[model samples]
Target chain A: MTTVEKIKPLVLIVDDNSTNIDLLVNTLKKDYRLGVAKNGQKALDYTEKHLPDLILLDIMMPGMNGYEVCGRLKTATRTKDIPVIFITAMTETAHKTRAFEAGALDYITKPFHTAEVKARVKTHLSLKKAREHEIYIASKIQKTLLLGQPPRDINGIQIAQLTIPSQKVDGDFYDFFKINNQCFDLVVGDVMGKGIPAALLGAAIKSHFLRVLNELIRLTDKKEFPDPEKIISSVHSSMIDQLEDIETFVTLCYARFDMAKYLLSFVDCGHMRTIHFHADSNRCSLLRGVNMPLGFPEQEPFKQTLVSFQPGDLFVFYSDGLTEAKNQDGVLYGEKRLVDFVQKNAIMESKELINIIRKDVVAFSQSDIFDDDLTCVLVGIEKKSTSQALSDKAKLEIKNDLTELARVRDFVRNFCEGIPGFPLDNNRINLIELAVTEVTANIIKHAYGEHTGERIQINALLLDDKIVLQFYDWGKAFDPKSVPLPVFDGSQSGGFGLHIISHTVDEVVYSRDKKGRNCASLEIKL
Target chain B: MKLSTEKIGEVTVVTVLTEVLDASNAEEFKTATAPILKESNKVVFEISQIKFMDSSGCGTLLSFLRQLKSSNGNLKLCRVQEPVRILFELVRIDRIIEIFDTKEEAIKSFKMGI
Candidate 1:
């Protein structure tokens, strides 16, 4: 149950004559909250400050007539829905018609029978309250859908997004989805206009995109992610009929970030060109868009552009609201300012950069209100730490399967070879490889119970004339000391694995963490 | 590791066709010859192609010898390369399996019925 209790509906009585106001006040004061506006301008100002459920008007005001006041109220979007009832002395049919034309909901003669006035006011107030409640619920649902939880980071890419709606429901939205463990997709879109219609279209387009993506994932090979161009085209095709029916178009940009290759492939559908800030060069470049906005032509060929990213590189995707935002002086905050801002702050974190850009735009516009919905998505590629770049350390993850034993050996050998001071003679490297293979085999056979998807993470470090290898697994706990040493009598085929692992390394230890993860550390003094 | 076999009078002669028999290729060599050892009691391995052998390589040979002997058969090594011969001496593998200088000598030992 809602905590706040319902108070009586407020009604504004606008009349030039005090006697008429008193008459209305005495009739309704006990039942409603009341406001008195002596002239047309005062009534407008009062309505602007506080929205009243109903307005009682007199047609014979001095400066601005009741018809003019009603006309102004009907024209403004915010107050147009508020019901206005004209109470006047004129009884002619022409006068009543004029009252209706001026946006009055009901009319009454000047005598103003108490019963008639009360009944009309009560009916109009109830109708207004019902409509407001309906809109409030609709806006709440739209808000939750528009701002659903989006991933902040996927793999090594950092994502930050900002959306400011011009109305209760924004037509602009951005989304983030992980295609796989190493690949993620970032999508930003803008519908043609604002408010309820545009918002519904935005939701429909988002749902369509998700449906098409799921279909593509199901149909394609497991190793292959959905193609960005094909996804856009499919979503566009499915939504074209509805979009045409609504007679609107949407601009969208979809980019897929591949963490392994450090590549970004994207399709821009007549959207604002995305900005790329190159960390190495400290320069910003706008990516080219090659296709028309969706829901336009039947078969617009969607071409995607591929860009390679380096560590510390930043990508900015935004709607036109930022570029078209104007100051009090009517100067547009153009693309140049955005480029300059990004280039200057390219070294900052992705979230910080997004926040600063949002603040800058607000300061430039000199107002909190935006005429158009504005949205921005910032993605940053992580930079390698200095120690990681200098040290001879490598981390590898492999499936818990025996066939991957060879791969584990290859990874360890490669890491040992990277040490400049120690070539790590073939014999020592061979022994290390054997120990790694044995450990991995044991994990696959014992710890994971021959499971395939479970992962074993091995971190190899060559530090201070020693080689240390640490392994972690979220499988069942394993006690190295509990495994009896195998007799070296040359006939034991199965138990030799653990014995060889223990003898090959200088020191071996195993323990389980509080979270039930198994950690094994092995060291070799070379 | 690659293998080729020739049969003469119920004795199987298998040759390893690689220069090095170290850790990387040792397991594969064992896998390739396990079926042959399981089938034949009298087997001869021509290892002249192997110039180097590591401890894993020696262990694999010992395992093969043990498996063969348990099945009432015997294994002989012929055309022993010098590096492999040194490895065999280091591991004292020469005392367990018969070693010969040529494939004919190994085949003669298997056929001598001693």
Candidate 2:
């Protein structure tokens, strides 16, 4: 093949005798590009500058002998993989044995055989390429495991997660286990170190935890989910002996959420604290756990903290990879930034919120790949179901008829029933019922204007010691501000409708919503 | 709607016997008690039996009070229960009417006229 048409494999030939170098160069020059180094020092320097496919060295040199050169090359990470072959005049078995002891792939006797040299070099090169290909396939398999599809919504909790592994494989792992319809357990963990060993340890811990959880579920006669603290303690105690022998430990956070009671119980085994954002009050707080990392001598019992979560609440579980993420200028994306981002975007859906944060981190760090595994899990309690709903809010839709007014009144009455210290008495219920009825009657008369098939939706929520009622209608909208208060001097007959409604409720508001629908809301203080 | 009337000197004390005075029966209550307002210039409504009331019920009382005030007389409420009192204060209707804890106290307010 012409030199310009085909790329050639590089081979370095090192020797003190010019005649011996000429012999090997002539034999290998046609098949490979040749680089010559007369002594051991030049050979090492040439390999350092440009790695070659093979090196042929003479065992006897004036300074820095071939055996010493091969030993030094094998010690370095960069040059260790270069195949080395020794050439010597001594055909004694001891001399050849010494050459092999110093890290030679093979030794050539003085009467050089060209066929043997070519065959050995070709065999070792093919073997090295096959090993590299195996590593590439292994990395691809690990990536698929890291990026497995996770369900977006589990029960009433919306979940969003992201993991940006730093290498082909990672030392971080996260998983979710569904216990029942109303409960599930989730975990996020980081092994003690990075690379292949850490990755394997992470995999082992995950599979072991899953097996134990399923076993506990199977052994139970009564239907009860495994407690997070119990699960952590069991895993830690079981894996402690093995981990200590390897001189490594894992930091993990395991949590279980009960949708029926809106409670989240979790234990942190030397992991980062979990952050909670309360939608009711628009405040944020950290939930901390007190325990050593798994595999350490049990300093304290693994304690779980129980928190009452409400609808529209957010819980953020993340690894140190996110907190220690550095920008181009080497500044960390710390806790304050994360907290502030969550506070501003708490109103967003869980997936959208996570995407925004992920994008921001990427932009701030100025790189798509992180220096460590960037792992985060966001859990959000969706707004409660409004139909048959008895939480802080109740919503209902009905036709624009006077008969539907009674059901609306009942809806509001049932919502006001359990509010502590509020006006749930008979007279108060009647007053609220009357006020709502009057407002509905007006909407049916003026807004709908005889199209009784149209619908009106009402949503009631209790906030800040006041019961706020929101009325939504798709009919013709009107501004309550333009409507003058009726004259109650026993002269005006028909305008008393709005007067009675506005006076009975604490506050009244009227505006058009984003969908171009009329929204008439009222609030009554407890 | 049930009602019982007794003459307490110059004031007629008409007691509401039904526990509720709401839209379901406020019109009947107004029709049934029309003669009581005309029977005496000064009247006292004994509402101790009223456990629930609404805007229509409040309108019924306002109509009677207006009729008495035009004739240089007054209408007063007595034995107003706590829940009904809250409804009155919430709507600011309590500012126009005099409320008392007992029938004797309400009747005395009109008789003394101080």
Candidate 3:
């Protein structure tokens, strides 16, 4: 616990000879904490409890040889990464090769060279530490750069994403950057390579895209988003020579989402064609482009295409890793199966639908291991156009009494659930139920007074970002402002209903429509 | 409201067998619990069944506490649902009302007399 107690790397020495154990203990004790095992079984039992950083194993013993002991250690997941060096009196090439077959990293033939043993142990320990540190840095970079929090409140857009960066993190990236209040960018890219070089290049290319965006932003108006085409073309022009030098090409799909206009402008550089599903007609279409991958010899200027979407539409952007995923039969999962699945399941919530697709892909592959990053981004059009009505008006007439409050809740539920693509979650539904309850109760008690025979009509108006509930009554018009705020400490009972109505819903207004009917409308935002 | 009362010592535990305690059933709940309140000064409302409660429903519980306090008695609530508890906390009624996670804790509070 204290700084004086410096922790040492643990080394387990497995040798039957007393002289060799003595030499190994003396050489390693100064740098590492040492554990000794006289025989192979003792070594196995000792390792079961204590996980040494490195093991110096002997090749010959009475019951088990060093090769068998090392092989057993390699088989275990817990001790597999621990470096094992065989200590053998037999200097034959066959013996040393056998040690390597048993998973020995290096061998120190006896009449031990103390300096060589020390150097090998130190190098292996540092290598293990460096590997662990690299994984940690990769995870951190992936969390902050590759994966981002998508804007959930953007009206008309519901996005669900799944990206599993492999342990080695081979060059699969997805990123989101907000341009302005009305626009944001979603980009997914894949570096056509593997391991450390590809991962580094992928991270470099991702940040390079950001640099290009910033440079373009300075040259253009601040309010307008940097064009997706300009951004992609710039990245291709800058990186093409370097990529060709390295013999690697990067495929990218750069998409700009205009929140105010409900449009998606994108530039595709030889990436997989994004799938567009029309929930209204149950049809799926692939949106593809003609540009080559970033590093191709024949580079073409990037072309940006704009697409407008309506309610109940879905767009799915994916990696080739998805469609090229091979099962035990060695057949690709392919685009046709994915399209059919999305067409049938596009009407569901984005999270649920994306999860189903992810499960299907994983199942079809029959293994979690993938050659590349398994990634996909699904965008669901959640709201109707601002100028257009979502559907026919939903209205319900009930007796102006406290007992009829349940009917009002059912009307709200049926109205919301009946819409083609309602984006309201359960919590939102519960809040609406409570708000309507308070409003209807106030109407029955104040507006109608003791007139239980009077009937009240409620209309549900669906909008782009919110739903408006209109409660019409012929009784005296109720004034929402006249009712004071409810005392939170329970001192005032009169304003509790009004306080609930005002706080639970987004907006509440009381107005007298033409023929003297009191209309109390509550706007509830999704 | 199906009100079932069980007497533990001088404390009476009444469980309301209903999911909602909003404006629609606030009056029914008050009327149902009235006989139990008359029988026991120390009453613990086991409201695990009451899943939904708005401001009006919360108001009824506060009124019951006032009624009990006037007669030098106290009211406790236990097994409160998550939504109902949120409503009470939102209105700051949790400070005024004695709320506990279990019926035994509520009855113990009654015995503790604080």
- Misplaced by over 4 Å in model 3 are A1-104, A110-118, A162-166, A179-183, A192-200, A215-227, A244-248, A258-265, A270-291, A303-310, A316-348, A351-376, A383-526, B1-114
Q: Across residues B14-82, which tens digit of lDDT does each residue of candidate 3 receive?
A: 888988887778888889888877887778888898877776788888888878877789888999877
* Pairwise TM-score winner, candidates 2 and 3: 3
Better of 2 and 3 by DockQ: 3
Candidate 1 per-residue C-alpha lDDT over B1-114 given as tens digits, one digit per residue, 9 for 90 to 100: 689998888789999998766555678999999888877889999988886555567778878878888888888899997656754654567777789998898889877773
Worst window of 10 by summed lDDT in candidate 3 chain A: A383-392
Q: What C-alpha lDDT does candidate 2 achieve relative to the native structure?
A: 0.78
Tens digits of per-residue lDDT for model 2 on A185-277?
888888877666677778788877977787777877657766788788778877888899999998988888877567889998888878899
Return the TM-score for each candidate structure: 0.57, 0.44, 0.47
True contacts kept of each: 0.05, 0.12, 0.40
DockQ of 1: 0.08
Q: Which ten residues in a row have the lowest lDDT in candidate 2 chain A?
A: A145-154
Candidates in order have lDDT scores of 0.79, 0.78, 0.80
**How many residue pairs clash (N, CA or C atoms closer than 3 angstroms) in each of the candidate models, in the order given?**
0, 0, 0
